[model samples]
Target: MTTARDREILRLAVPAFLALVAEPMFLLADAAIVGHLGTLPLAGLGIAAAVLQTVIGLCVFLAYGTTAGVARHLGAGDLRGAIAQGVDGLWLAVLIGAAVTVVGVPLAGPVVRLFGASADVADPATTYLRIALLGTTPLLLMLAATGVLRGLQDTRTPLVVAVGGNALNVVLNLLLVYPAGLGIAGSALGSVLAQVASAAAFVVVVVRAARRHGAALRPDLPGIRAASRAGAPLVVRTITLRAAILVTTYAVTVGAVADDQEVDLATHQLAMTLWTFLAFALDAIAIAAQALTGRLLGAGDVTGTRETTDRMVRWGAWSGVVTGVLLAAASPWLGRLFTGDDAVRDLLVPVLIVAALGQPVAGVVFVLDGVLIGAGDGRYLARAGLVTLVAYAPVALALAALSAGLVAIWVAFCTVFMGARLVVLVHRARGDAWLVTGVVRAPK
Candidate 1:
């Protein structure tokens, strides 16, 4: 029984890990393409990307909220509810993605300008943002699909989409950036095209899922109503979480503006890239936490959910150790691969050390988020995130201002997330409250 349970947990977490890793691979490829364009171009890409992350992250409730609702529906065996979320979330995604693209394309320059992008990098940032924003509609749709699949315990579709999109992006990057001479714009364009392909691929999977597992509503009206109602809090929860993240990102932008800032644009970019990579990599455990916990919640097996959480968090810790060591070990080589600039390299390599070590903290936090969400506790997820941001973001900004170097910034980063994990862990462990009747139905 023990061996079987462990194997089952691994089954959920492995594809989840792959899916999570693939999500961040998109940006890493972009960073690589931009890095070769020389420092100014790279820096510009970094600043603009930060702004873009904030924007997209703010609206991420689309994915998280949808995932939670879908998971709950599946647990209740409401196939119609799951399908309803898939369809309605898709509708919501298209509109939201379109709005972002429209707003971003026109305001790309102004947004970067607001971030205090150096005069040299301003135009490049705008160019890059414009090209990338074109694919928002499709990208948003893909997010919706992934959320639905995750909720339904199907990681295969997301994995397929991720691989296909990444392959397309690589080919497009080679052709568009090199042969076509689109510069950074080509990088952005490549990503957009790749995401479109992913979206199309996922749509097919979603259709199949409906046919195989969903409740085949006549018009799917009832499923739609229930999903929409359940999804509202989730949406609000996600949007709020995103809003806080955006605020922190904005602080990073502000900190980047210091004249004596030890961390330049490339350095900042490297840190963010490293951060994104680690967070996504560790997110595999979170994905695991989500799937296993969701399944347990669906079946009303509270004990299974708790046990799964413990194992995944430990897995998260181990994964964090391995990832962090590798990143730190590769710091020198990574710096050389991306840039030849000695000054830029020195600053970034140290930051990489900080970035890597933070993975465990981040891993725990991310996994907790998934566990809680799967348990239908998005409201708590939202609150925890907001509180952490409030406490930690200011400290980061202050440290950055005091010394525009990587050490202070990273220390702050680690501290903030560690604090977050601790708080959540304590509460969950101390409370049997999660098992109370209707707690999942109407979570606090």
Candidate 2:
């Protein structure tokens, strides 16, 4: 990542950064609105979000997979390959999202119940979860579009689309969740609308780019199928990770109840929210790595990919440290946003403190995850992520039993994710032949 390459990467990453950041903005809005509704609704919303994310979160890899495959194709001077993946990615995303939308709507309540949310909490959670599930298709499309843009080294367009959508979300949330009086359902509606807008924007930009590049978005079927094949490993990895994280939420929630404390749940949710913020923010580096490194690999510039990945990892670490410090400093005010009860705030402070401390490690894990995905090392993602997430389940319960509350839970979380990433990243970096070769390997 020389200065010139850094600039080029930034040109793509910043937009991805902006768009991804917009995600939490919407979540924060939901939390704020639901917070105003009181403890039950807020808790329910948190549980709903967790459940929905578990089932649908795997779709997230569409962005990374598309970027890696498309960028490599472009780098290899195969505009056709890039277009094919883009088209196929869009179709694949739609297919998965549609299936989820259908299956999830019926199972929403059971999913919430499995998380041990109270009967009172389950209904609202189900309501919110179902609506959010509807947004999955558009969300995937928007994400996949970002991949296409990143491949072309055109990050700004996706960022603009994301911001535009975020702006729409904020407006909708303010209107629907409040004066309009839709309650939790309003939150879901706002999210879906925002995603739809962003997806539309991405499609427009992608179509325009295809025209400019003299490629067709309507890729040939054979090319689409081939690129689609290239994307499967990453999707499996993403879905596995999502499912693992989803189960952890249930474990944490049940443990909180068994520990005989309401604050346990609240505090953990607050800490996770903070974690989400840090993870999403620092993921910009990961996105940059995936885009640029994949481009280099595609172009047969293995040396460049190696150099850029190293630089991005360093950058991610530094940024994570800064973010941790800032988050720790802001914990007092941030805790108040979740709940103002002194006891709850007390529980929250320690959780945030430890969580903030782990930001650097978390950042490393995330950045590395993106790099590997970009490099097409996603086949092992399911096993790797499951190891990390599952490691925390018993620890969460044990900590809760020890009256350790949220701090212990987060500590366990840190350990699991850190340990899991440690092995996978090392394996890849150390020349694991099976996983090290990216999607865009040079012709023999």
Among these predictions, the greatest lDDT belongs to 2
Q: Model 2 TM-score? A: 0.92
Estimated TM-score for each candidate:
0.90, 0.92
Q: What tens-digit string does per-residue lDDT give for candidate 2 at 266-307?
A: 555666776787778888888888877777777777777777
Clash count of each predicted structure: 2, 0
Model 1, 221-320: lDDT tens per residue?
A: 4544544555555555555444544444445556665562323667777777777777777877676666567667777887777777777777777888
Q: Where in model 2 is the C-alpha error above 4 Å?
A: 218-228, 257-262, 400-403, 432-444
